[model samples]
Target: MIVVLIGYMASGKSTIGIILAKKLGYNFIDLDEYIEEKEKLKVKDIFTLKGEIYFRKKEAQYLNEILNEENRIVLSLGGGTPCYGNNLDHILNQTGVISIYLKAQIHTLVNRLKNEKSKRPLLAELENGDAVTEYIGKHLFERSHFYNQANITISTDNKAQNEIVEELVLALF
Candidate 1:
């Protein structure tokens, strides 16, 4: 089985996926990192060089590749992964693929992402915490439709990493 972790930026998908994979003895694959390794460039570089349209196409292709080929793995998707192309439909149609959305509040996401904006291409232009909060609020509103389609949804606010993982394990089993 493949467990796919889906969420907005700074929603703890990668962090939770690593721990969940460890607990379940499954390989952990962060789709962004996988893309960087395959493309020989950072995700930000991909956006700067080839552009988001190109990146999204490659991301969809690579996501299909991974879904078709991997097993017993935990996959962490990019923030916009499901919101693009036919990614969400493809994921839902796949057998043995379990999708989990790590839902986080706007304030929580703003607090978590404010310092890390430089690393995020989408959030890079935002100037301050207020800006980040506003961006996330709007972005999350748009993306929540895709995210809410996941087989499971776990709220992550005010929870420890281990607690989230534990909740994930229970949800899975």
Candidate 2:
């Protein structure tokens, strides 16, 4: 089975995904990192250089490639993965794949993402913690419709990694 973890930035998809994969003895792949490796550029650099349109096309291509080719993978997706161009439908319709959304409150997301803005190209332009929080609130509101399509939704607010993974495991079974 392929377990696809999807959520907005700093929602712990990658963090908890690694743990879940380890415990399940599945291969772990962070889609952004996979793109960076394949494109030979950091995701930020890709956006700065080739632009988001190019990046999104490649992202969809790579996502399809991985889904068709891999098994027993815990795949951590970029925040916008599901919202783009039929991607969510692709994941949902694919055989042997289960999509999980890591749901976090706006405040929880703000706390986790505020300090990490520099790492996120989309959030890099925001000027303050308040800005980050605001952006996340609006963005999450827009994206929730896409995210809510997940087979399982797990809240990560105030939860440790192991706790989240435990919930995921139970949800899976």
Candidate 3:
């Protein structure tokens, strides 16, 4: 089964994915890392050198390739994966694939993203706290439609990793 985790940046998809995979004995694959290794560049570098269109195409290809595998695994998708293409539909059609949205409040998201903003190209460009808040709000408004299409949505606002993991385990399987 492919348990795909999706949400806005810093919503804890990767973090919760690792815990869920470990608890369920499933392999965990962060799609961004996979793309980095394949393209031989950091994700930010890919966005810089090749452009977002190129990166999105590669990401779709990687997602298609991984969907063919038979192993039970959890995949953490990039924030924009579902919003931009046919990726979400492709995922929905595959058997044994359950989509989980790690939904977080805007304030919580801003706080979580503050420290790690440098690593994320999109968030790195925001000028100030208000910018960050507005950025998240606008993007979340745009992506929430696709995100809400997930089979299960877990609120990660102020929640501990283990607690979220427990909720996922009970709700998913």
- Give the range of the ten consecutive residues with the poorest summed lDDT in model 2: 109-118
lDDT, each prediction: 0.96, 0.96, 0.92
Clashes of 3: 0
Which tens-of-lDDT digit does each residue in 1-55 have in candidate 2?
9999999999999999999999999999999999999999999999999999999
Off by over 4 Å in 2: none
Model 3 poorest ten-residue lDDT run: 63-72
Q: Estimate each model's TM-score.
A: 0.99, 0.99, 0.98
- lDDT string for model 1 (1-173, tens) is 99999999889999999999999999999999999999999999999999999999999999999999999999999999999999999999999999999999999998898889899999998888888888899999999999999999999999999999999999999
Compute the lDDT of residue 145 as modeled in candidate 2: 98
Order of models, best lDDT first: 1, 2, 3
User: On a 0 to 100 scale, what is the lDDT of residue 12 in model 3?
Assistant: 94
Model 1 residue runs over 4 Å out of place are none
Q: Candidate 3 residues 1-173, lDDT tens each?
A: 88999999999989999999999999999999999999999999999999999999999999888888646899999999888779999888888899999999999999988888789999888888899999999999999999999999999998899999999999887
Kindly provide the TM-score of model 1 when superposed on the true structure, using C-alpha atoms: 0.99
